[model samples]
Target: MESMNESNLTALAAFNHNEALTKIPTFLFLVLLTPFGIIGNAGVIYVYGCRLKKTNLQHFITLLAVFDIVCCLVAFPLKMVELWLPVMYPSGNLCKVQNSIICFTCVASALTLLIISVDRYKKVCRPTQSQMTLCHAKILFSVITVISLIYSVTAAFIYDRRSIPLDSDGYLVGYTCVMDFNSVVTQGYFLALFVVLVIVLGTMLVLYCLVWKEAKKHFMQSDLRYRHSENQEDGEDHTSPHKRNLHRTNRTVVLISLLFAISFVPSLLVSVLFAQFTHVQFSMTTRTIRELIYGTWALNSSMNPLVYGFCNENFRTEFQNLRIPFGCYGRYPAPKKNDIKSIAQV
Candidate 1:
């Protein structure tokens, strides 16, 4: 009997060690990502919100940065605490708030991406159609905030503190934030979130496909015209700025979408599996996979500024001149009315 008890304790200790090892990735992400996310997103917000002229594109990009900031400041810290002290995370209210903020950021970011795709499609594919204006962007932002808030509140209600058994005898235990797996409503909520994500991603994919097709056709015609132009000087094609900018914008959108897909798909898939197959005992491998996927969220939030800096010339210029130490402000030149109009046509 003593040997049996010793063996059980040994097994529990090994399991605890493994669990701690599995959390290392998440901890590293949170530690490395928090500062970068906060600073990078803050820079984006500063450039778009304070430096540039107010445009639909600026608004949407700023909003995305805002969501990323919330994830970094609120969600990431709570997650780190939860992982570090799985047994003693203050209270259920904190967990609820953390989950709520996570939900809000995810929902808001996805919807904003969808809206940006629609806006890009309209501008690139249908030049004669009405483009999204600043007013329209404001309306859409408010709508998304309200919609996201509603869903997030629902998430807050869905999660609570749950006890985790650390031994076969249930003598050693830990508390963690979790939802009711046995509840049909909880499972259904997760299923609904998954369905919504799929639909949003699908719609964005279609819009981008059409936009790319149109942009390619437009670029080919422009290239042909430039090649045959009588005023071509020194074998230089000067009419390619619009095409370059257009391609850069397209690349930025693609990168953001790809990041979102890579970050969210695995996490959501694991969530769906756990929700739908509650009866199935998840092995250590599965749990480790889930933790790794969850860690990707921080990477996703931290990467958008890099994407913007690398893909957009305007953003790159601003970022280059963003000297923090000297307190000298870098000014982004406001586009002239004609330049704005020409950009809109592109």
Candidate 2:
């Protein structure tokens, strides 16, 4: 029994050594993802921060995008370093800091999405209820801020570097700021947090479904009323504007739903898998799969800009105009005197 245990430990060490050496491909892949993520997420922040006036929904999404960008910036570059220079890298303290930031930002993003869903639910399902006021938005923001700070500090302290015996080799292996999953406190905390995240995400999904159903029902009824009104006017153009606006709103909602799913689902799945399968050893085969999962999660940072540009008419117009050169802008027709006068009258 002693011999078998020694052999197993020897094999695991060899596996880790081999895995550490072959990280070039992973590094190069991250090099590709990082720039796109930075550019796209920055664009999202600019759009929400500069163009849109401050509102509860916009505030939540703007901050969420900011957190996503911060997480990618803090975590992905270190991940590349860990991949490329696994041996020479001194991640003793950096790992703890980066991991904590990642965790906090990820939790903040999830909470923001939950808030957005609840807001939509109230707006659609219970429209009679008062809209979320500025005070309410501020309180929610403060709560998220406090929770994220507490989580980051706690995780950073708990996940310090440790030295453990390796096999019977009489030598110690030093782990640098990686979570000690075997520790009782670590396991318990993770289990509880995982359950909370699952419940929050599940609630968001259910609420979104309810919002969609309610929106559909209300839209159909509104369409019917508009059609009846038009019919009373001998099928004239009374309903055209209403129908156009409804179509635009529906399109926006569908796009937002798709973006949310694309951005979040991969990370959520990876988290659940990690929680459930604690004993799954990291191997060459699993390395690529793990990188892919992280890469997919990183893509969310890029997807936000695309979603905004495609779904929001105002954003699309702004993006197009911003892309044009000054010379090109000069070539466009200026407003006529009568048009300026009419605008002033309005």
Candidate 3:
């Protein structure tokens, strides 16, 4: 009996050793990514919201950065806490709050991207129609905030701390945050979330396709006009500045949406599997995989600034201007009036 008890102790120790190993990499990655996300998103807010002339596109970008910052500031830390002490944390309320806020930020980000797509579609595909105004944009942003809050509340109610068996012998069980997969309501909730994601993605894809078709036709016309005027002596550029700005804005939003889709879909899929398959028991390996998947989603929030820097000239220029306070302010000049006018036209 003593020898059997000793063997159980040895196995439990091994289980813990493996569990820690699995979580460490994800934990460290989040720890490193969090500060960069916070600082980068903050810079985005500063430059677009304050430094640049206020345009609708700038407003959308600023708000999106705000949502991303919440993910980095609130969600990432909660996730790191879960990873660092998965077994010892006992507050169900804290778990619920953590998961709920994470859901809110994610839903808000997705909806913002959808709105950007619609804006692009209207400008490019239906140029003669009435376009979205600043007042309308504000109203829509308020609506998005309310809807995200209401949708995310469900997560707070669904999740709770439960015992996750850590050893095959069932000698060690770790208390972790999760929902009961056996519950019909939980399965339905996940299914609904998945449906929403698919619909949002599908709608964006269709809208972008139509916008691209129209843009191609318009650009071809512009190219022909440019070629026709090339031999003239006036030396005026035939391309419309407003149209050029709109195209650049479209490309930037598309890149951001792609990043979100790539990171978010896999995390949501893993979650749906957990809810749909009741027999899907938690193991250290599976937990590690889930954490890594979530890390990708968190990484998405950090990455948008990089996308902005790469794709948008205005954003890139302002980002350089940010370095000026350290005795380099004279190196980069403020955006010209014509640049601001072009953005305003979009």
Candidate 4:
């Protein structure tokens, strides 16, 4: 750090502030995965979105894939270019444009996950409650779209491709994309985002508790039924088909929920820290750890389809039926429309 003209000092301070961050490899690793995530998440959207009929759950899942697609295609690539370029011009508006997409996709995905959990809670714990319809899903989607757009609009105002001056004479040199945290508006915007995270996480926690309680009650009733029916049949597997389906669905949901918590909690916490403590010291190792933890969000997007396929029976069945290139696959079971809908509902 060196003393210089006010304007030069301001820009140089910002440059060196983020300079140590470049030493972190986690950011670059994600940059490299941009292509893989785009391809994989797009494939997920195609497989799930194209075949599934209009249903609330399917709509929400498809929306998740869509958000992941946008992040991989739009946000991640922009970030990749920013990291790769040796020098960016302030005129390019890199930070604002790229971060705007980041804010939109990340917040939209979080809200969508909250919606999915709420839908599940309703179905599991409050079966008498009115079911979510396709139209309702559409309205929810529209609201989130508008909300994310409005929230992310702040990014465009708060970030910039800042030019760094080299010497006291203010010779032009290189520039970097950074958030203009000096603005009161930027801090306020981030504080708002922190509140949003708290609300989403709280909703998820409440829904999870309700679902768990309902699952326990169902398990007890199912055990009683099985015990009562066992006296009629000798050495029969008392588990019914419907119970098996519910068990499978519950297992899948539990796995996804655990993964969601693993991926997003750290990111949300770091975001709050950034909002409240912008001037905190940064080391290569510390920032690297943060990047690695937060990068789970990106990994989660592509991992979702795989998690579903591995944990859910229906997804495995559908995946097996997926057409192979050049028709190398043998005969496949074509699930009936009702069967697919049942799986989607699960």
Candidate 5:
């Protein structure tokens, strides 16, 4: 089994050797992406963690943001190092640790997003019967923590280097540490993780679609009610006080749904594609296409802030009032008293 795995890996390495270089561009883009991710996710953490009233949903979302931040921090730096330094510069243990951190954080982020979607669906579609209490939030947190730890440990144990070639010649290449993805345990772990991610994400997507439809139906009913009231007012000399409020709420729901779809769907699609296609021995053109698709996933992190600002009025106002640090390009207002309080809480 070990010999067969080594042969497969050798073939894969040879196959990938002639592909287009990815290190430089990917690194440069990651460097540009890191600050955006940090700022956007940090703001989300702040809003949900400190500014908003304490609730299970809010806490879960805050933790999701934190998970995203961790993902960016862990994965981006290692990616940069891999791009610039020699691929074998890192020791075996360091590589294992880095890979495990990346895997753990990325999985945690995905699971947390799933949790957020489910939480939102419940609150929006089944508010009265929703079981999302503080205790539920605690349980969710514990579950995610346990899952992340287990994933990290498994990854660490499963990743290692057995041998390296001495040179570019067919005879031998220099020894370098690399993950043994050919191992049954490693492959099986990845396959299981991908399966779980797909199932959870797909379920959440379905729930969100149902929630959206129901919300839209409720919005239409509210609209009809307002129109009826307006017609009666035209006939009887009366005005409807709740008409504007209903419209505002409807707009809010639509905007939030739109933001979620736009910011999240691309990343989900990329993840699915990568899971299915990464191991395929594609032509250069196809490989390029894959890279492009994967690159768009970074947009998800960058656009998160824009989505939040557009969907949430509070975030918009707070962002506009954010005080820029010295030497920054953009104008920003001083922090509000509430912002100060939130910061203090943090």
Candidate 6:
């Protein structure tokens, strides 16, 4: 009789109304965020990929937009469904699959950003380094995509569909997706993720600093020369095209990096905290804050197009001319007859 009672306890767990209620606002935020993110990333894709004649850098940005669109269109929507109406989620591997897609997009997006940083570093810091032509960009992009996919496989395989009973009778009344954080294999995966992020961000930061220092020195010298010249020609533009392009590209990269760091780093740190410290407990407020952080992170995708518009004059002009539901290519002003490669690397 005692053995049967122990088995029953293992099979059944009560669903908590209070916890579900606590998640209400998070679900609501996701509901409102999903549509905007989809539209924003879609606009970015169509504008950058189709309307503009893409440079190698533009091609990279377009790919980033594609990943962000996937996040908005598929990953987060599935997550929202899971949170809002979990009963609708079929049992078995479906939940794991859903998480895999979400995690994949996140990893891909980060890797894409890492690529962008490397591209910029090469262009700005070593102008004579062989330029990344469209072909090279394609190869690099493909390599990173494959790497990110491989990294994301752990997320797919780590989780299992679990059923918990809601009462003492051992009746399974609820199902969930669960991963064992305590398991060595799962923690290894988490460690890999944490370490990769740290390495990528650190390298990006170092490269950015070097680029910025070079740019600042160049600018200061230019200013000094201007000041020394008493009779400078009013119409003369002394700044070289190469330098101007470098400056503009650096500005864009820095802005995007700052935006990404601000939006995602907090949530990522919190996640690391939870994973590393099993004894740590979260209160209702802490969970709520976590949801808000995640929502803001999702909202980051919507904000990228705006960043492009704010930083790139050409993008703004082309976006202005975009026709709703019409496939008109915008006027991109490079020498290429059909595909205008941007002068500045993104």
Candidate 4 lDDT over residue span 1-346, tens digit each? 3554566546655665465356346557776667666765665565567555766766777787788777777766666566554244444566777788878876787788788888888888888989888788999999999999988898788878776555457564567676676788877887788788778778887888888788777777776687687674657777655666666666665566566667666776775566556556667677667656656666655566666677666766765556643322235544578877666644
Model 5 agreement with the true structure over 204-242: per-residue lDDT tens digits = 668767766776666666666766866764455332334
Winner on lDDT (2 vs 3): 3
Evaluated against the true structure, the overall lDDT of model 2 is 0.63
Q: Which 10-residue window of candidate 1 scores lowest in summed lDDT?
A: 324-333
Best by lDDT: 1
TM-score of 5: 0.69
What is the per-residue lDDT of model 3 for residues 185-206, given as tens digits with 9 covering 90 to 100? 6777777777877878898999
Model 2, residue 275: displacement in angstroms? 7.4
Decoy 6 TM-score against native? 0.79
Please identify which of the two predictions, 1 or 3, would achieve the higher TM-score against the true structure.
1
Model 5 per-residue lDDT at 161: 40
What is the C-alpha lDDT profile of model 1 across 33-66, one tens digit per residue?
8998898998888777766667787788889999
Compared with the true structure, all predictions reach lDDT values of 0.79, 0.63, 0.77, 0.69, 0.59, 0.68
Candidate with more favorable, higher lDDT: 2 or 4: 4
Q: Candidate 1 versus the native: TM-score?
A: 0.85
For candidate 1, list the clashing residue pairs, or say none. Answer: none
1 or 4, which is superior by TM-score?
A: 1
- For residue 140, model 4's alpha carbon misses the true position, in angstroms, by 0.9
TM-score of each: 0.85, 0.74, 0.84, 0.79, 0.69, 0.79
Preferred candidate (lDDT higher): 3 or 4: 3
RMSD of each: 4.5, 7.4, 4.6, 5.6, 8.0, 5.4
Worst 10-residue stretch by lDDT in candidate 4? 324-333
Residue 244 error, candidate 1, Å:
1.1
Model 2 Cα lDDT, one tens digit per residue, 133-195: 868988998899888877777678666555544446945353434566667777666666667
